[model samples]
Target: MEHEDPLVTAEWLKENITAPDVRVVDATWFPPFLNMEKTGRQAWSEGHIPGSVYFDIDAIKAGGTDLPHMLPDPVMFSSRVRKLGIGDGNRIIVYDQFKFFASARVWWMLRVMGQKDVKVLDGGLQAWIDAGGELEDLPPVPVERHFTARVRSDLVKDANQVLAASEAGSHTIIDSRSPERFSGDAPEPREGLPSGHIPGSICQPSGELRTPDDRLKSADELRTLFADPMAPTISTCGSGVSAAVTALALARLGNWDVAVYDGSWTEWASDSSRPIAKGAA
Candidate 1:
């Protein structure tokens, strides 16, 4: 199957929102530190693209793990998304309220689960509004669709694999956290977790991958940002969220082989046995 572009514009989404095979997903999420009054679902309930469903990353995740939003087992994932009316032969477009934030995470999740034809909405909900698209408070009642989860193990990495990559240097470990957090200069948002990144990992803040308007930067700019774009890479961030942004950026550069370290800093730093490196990479 020919791979589609990893991103879609609001204009395109507006035109295709009502298509039978198109599924629009609102994947908006905010950090607990933000203490936002409205949850992603609340915001979506207030107003969202017509015919769109909400995917709560926090709710649908691996069980028996304290780690936040770890990828659920294939059976669980298939069941969850199927209930959301996301299934085979559907073109899924994911978007977040904070422009380019959490949508990429959902996109990465779907891709990891072997769902093809999935894309992130460029610039997110704001872009939709900017494009003169309308929002609706009434949610659609969708019939369950048959979603088969084909797990792509290569697209997700665990703490052990990340450790191997860090120690053996087999893969380029890209830290998507802010420089301050990556360098151990700032405390982590999660209580009791020390700052500092994995040894030999390079810092590339996910925020830098986007334009002022929240759209991803041009391919040339991304190529410059990732000096060695073709290298085998693993994206990591706070609790595996922003890591997807890094993965999305790499995908934009036509590099789809990048894997996301699901545990990321949260799981890595929690274990005292793991080595931590401070300062710029």
Candidate 2:
């Protein structure tokens, strides 16, 4: 499905936040390696956009997997989001404390689950504050809304599919990890996981797509960064979080065909059988 701009400005959200048909979601998250003292829920409890519910990426994930924040089943997704008062016909707006970080992951998750009108809050919480938006510690009591998941398989890829793309050279694999990590110079935050990237994948650090002010770069700039706008691309990151940033950037350039490798590096490196390549792509 063709989606309108996958982003909404803080001013736009501030104006429509109270609308019955709108739901604002806070997707704040911190990598486990950071050793953050406060969890995303704790951060949300302190202050958040008024009426916004916290969408914990870590909690709302596929069960029975050692993987970090893997996509949950449709039934789980539908049930969890329903309690957030997110359902059909409601426009969902997601934001994160760190600008465009975890919010894009949530946005991508919603999109892949077939939510027609999900968008990230451009510049995230800071943008909201800058736009004279107020924050409230009190959480809203959300009325349940039924959410139906018409899973969009085209938007997601598994390890086998990514490996085939890497071998056949039919698709472009875009790794969103940092240059050091992509090149094997830096150790992975996850212990015992070797550094380096998938064979033939190109490194496009997600941070580079963001401007100095924490907003995404213009579409023209993003087009240049991506090089080939029409390539069938699969975005991958340390786990699967930042890859959504790449997907969002491409979607901003009117390229919605980009698929995210859901398991990403963590999944790829976990198994010794997968081929790993070092140095530049």
Candidate 3:
């Protein structure tokens, strides 16, 4: 399938599997509700695409941040990418087995750092497997190449910034949590956080971007997904994880100003002083 942007389908990835300067990264992650019994590293060891590297989303994170998996420093992120066999010139194809989760996070992270040619593998690993693609018993030993990270600060925002925006009504906050969670009808997965979303935020469950078979929906469908009173949005979710998916979806649509609320609702609701809206965003 051809896209106007830089997405590669399973069939496209399979055909390009052996191409030079092409790198595939497995950005798989599970929510607290769905543990893989082991981490993605162990999963990669058991079996992964041949010549692929594992991009541990949680491990490569911003240190010294109150939130989980905040963006890592530019220098640190660049070093990590190089160690993973990625470079500025290479085309990146990222995917995750758990439908659409951390895969988009990787895609967004790379693109934010000004890597113009990165793309997500449509449908992730399941689609690859269904397409008769082969797998390997281990990840390839990568010869480290230089992957530079130019910090695109505009693409990210901290909890404080989001709080300020919520008060001033300067930007639309798009919460990627389930409707029940956003509405306070469901308890948050992370303890100590109050139920509900930020006042004035909009609810667009990140899972809406996925098709029935776990493939990413077409851009046309995505355009419809973001159509709401909420415009010019920032994305937030349970502890800033899946919220990145919302940012990724927006980025794919060329919303360059989008940001991921680093602390997300976990930090927001945990602080009783922060204002919240109990029902409907």
Residue range 105-174, candidate 1, lDDT tens digits? 9999999899878999998999999999999999889889999888899999999999998899999999
Candidate 2 Cα outliers beyond 4 Å, as residue runs: none
Deviation in angstroms for 105 in model 1?
0.6
What TM-score fits each model? Answer: 0.98, 0.98, 0.92
Looking at model 3, the pairs that clash are: none
Write candidate 3's Cα lDDT for 203-261 as tens digits. Answer: 99988877899876776788888764235677888877687777666655766567878
For model 1, the stretches where C-alpha displacement exceeds 4 angstroms are: none
Question: Against the true structure, candidate 1 has what lDDT?
Answer: 0.91
User: How many clashing pairs does model 1 include?
Assistant: 0
Arranged by TM-score with the best first, the candidates are: 1, 2, 3
Under the 3 Å rule for N, CA and C atoms, how many clashes does model 2 have? 0
- Candidate 3 segments exceeding 4 Å error: 1-3, 228-230
Residue 143 of model 2, lDDT score:
91
lDDT by residue for model 2 (183-269), tens: 999999999999999999999999999999899888888878877967899999998999999999998888888999999999999
